[model samples]
Target: MLIKSSKQVSRWRTPKRFPVSRNSGASPASRIEPGVSWPEPEGATRVQRFKVYRHDPESGKNPRIDTYAIDRDKCGPMLLDALIKIKNEIDPTLTFRRSCREGVCGSCAMNIDGTNWLACIRSLDEISEPSTVYPLNNMDVIKDLVGDQTHVLAQYQSITPWLRSKTPAPAGHERLQSPEERKRLDGDYECILCFCCTAGCPSHWWNGDRFLGPAILLQAHRWLVDSRDEATGERLDELEDPFKLYRCHTILNCTRTCPKGLNPGKKIAEIKLMIQQRRS
Candidate 1:
């Protein structure tokens, strides 16, 4: 090659080869042992300690943190697994609620690493070290991780989530709903009632008594958008109250925190339109 200018000689050169794998180029499956962690040389430690919050109401004591150590390499990185190890081996008295162990049951809802999440679905790797778990904020704490959901249940009942059509269906026939109508309620109907949206709403903090919040509004959308329902006008009337509809500040917290990817804000907008159109 011919010699180049000074500027060309000063140019940086990129590396031609990447670093080799540390594990002798072995595939991950070949190295991994089922039900047992891969060897980590001699005297390797794989324990992670979590700073879990604890509170007892009957004793009238303050909330506190209790450290729990769990073997990270043995089980998956799910927070629920850590909790189970803590409960079984570390502290049997530690209190928390979980069911189904899947994301379907909302019983494991709590603040993990300062955000409301279902412990069953939240991986330990996503959380910061020394993670803090607490009962959901703005709700009554029944114990350590359990919340008194009587208020959320009351609001759910206030909106009347079930169908209430003025016309009853014939005994032998079903209420026919077209595919178009079914598609209308798709996004709004997937709510798992995890209460993450409700806990994040500022309107809930101020006027939970009158404002139904996003969960109820989404449930209302499920009914109002259904073509088979004859009580759309009546449901609109109930939602016409300013506090019930306008109290939502469009903060978008409900949509952001929804575990099932439902948009409560969008459903509330539809409710607003139904109320306005019916009045006119």
Candidate 2:
């Protein structure tokens, strides 16, 4: 085959018409950015070590901890800040899930300093000891610091996680809740489903499939206690199985490890009480 000239090939390969969208015309339409990163933080003299767990299922290798150095002054105070810095500057391959860096999203749950917490909230400067971060323990890692949230998410979906009331409210208004009725949802509403409570649970780790676990049980109580929602019996029916609800052996790890200060154990105890009362 005859080869084309260099100029002909270059003209043939270069894109000619980049049709711009009307909405995105004012903004840069191209998603690709140059391989550029911020230089090491200025005025940041102190360096802190982060032992981050690294894994790649595609590589066919065992997991290992990779050390990364971060300039304390250069990074934000939270552990997530440092992790993001590492990902953005040092290694773009480093991966973890994070949203709403204020800890409200619960997406950054991981084992930091031997405790389960939302990395966005855990302050790096608060702990004087050296730090090691791992994905939520006992979870199958899809990548570094990303646990398979399917189990907890499936259990959460099993709860249906919404009001299932059949009773219709007045024509012009929605179902109104009283102060007392709304108070019942206080502790349960705070759960962000970051998997910290379930991940910290030893019983959950052992029987995660059978056990509904703390986070699911917590949502169960959220509905069971809602006075405005008239689905208590159904909620209890969904959770009354011996393995599903009773497996929470009051280990209290769910409460102790909850970053939101909500007691999932106590709320679980409340669900047990509801089941017992229904039987009585």
Candidate 3:
């Protein structure tokens, strides 16, 4: 190929650049300085402030709290709705788990304003001040609002929550229980394994290595009290260790913070009572 001279190369034209509009579809309020209150959008009547914890291990920076201003009138009444609005409209990088926007899934469980709760069920009106949101306490945070629940789930699995009977069920029939016997499972059976109670317990915070936290212990009690189960003795044997069962000091934090409002403290006490009766 023939080489172009300096005059020929200098005459070549470059592509034209267009000026971008300052007021584009993107919201300028999204890039506002941290800790500053975001301005209310046009036609928005109410603005709710939220301070959420943010962390990314790969960023090699210290964790921080991010402030977000949500238009209350445009969003749903629940805290989870505000979170979703932030993730979708304001900051796409915001991360949190949510499903079944109702309370049944327990996926949106987090610490809000110093209490562990399911965000989907918690009304935004309940928070009088600027709400603070965080991941569940005493658990490793995987990212913004997502916590690592591997240990808590492992402890739950150790309890053998399914029915265990020495004798198999009758051919082609499931195990049956009387209505009175079924009533025994009312408080215990409702647990959704959210681990909110476990994360809230001081005993688990201190002795999580060995102690089965309130959630797992409550699940253990569920199996122990099952009318169709025949492994009470074996289950009790597994939970007899001092750290495994007796570490609970009855601070009632578990009971106070359970999002489901089930009494895990009472269930743990019942387990202790059963063990005491067996020994006596």
Report the lDDT tens digits of candidate 3 across residue range 185-243. 99998899887888888788788989999999999999999999999999999999989
Scored against the true structure, residue 52 in model 3 reaches a CA lDDT of 85
lDDT of 2 by residue, 188-270 (tens): 89888888889988889788888988988998889888877887788888888888998999998777778888889999898
What CA RMSD would you report for each candidate?
15.4, 19.1, 19.7
Top of the candidates by lDDT:
3
In terms of TM-score, how similar is model 1 to the real structure? 0.79
* Superposed model 1: Cα runs more than 4 Å off: 1-44
- How many Å off is the CA of 1 in candidate 3? 89
The CA-based lDDT of model 3 is what?
0.81
Order of models, best TM-score first: 3, 2, 1
Q: Specify the poorest-scoring 10-residue window by lDDT in model 3.
A: 5-14
Residues 56-88 of candidate 1: C-alpha lDDT, one tens digit per residue: 677655555666666677666688888887777
lDDT of 2 at 179: 93
- RMSD to the native, candidate 3? 19.7
- Among the numbered candidates, top TM-score falls to 3
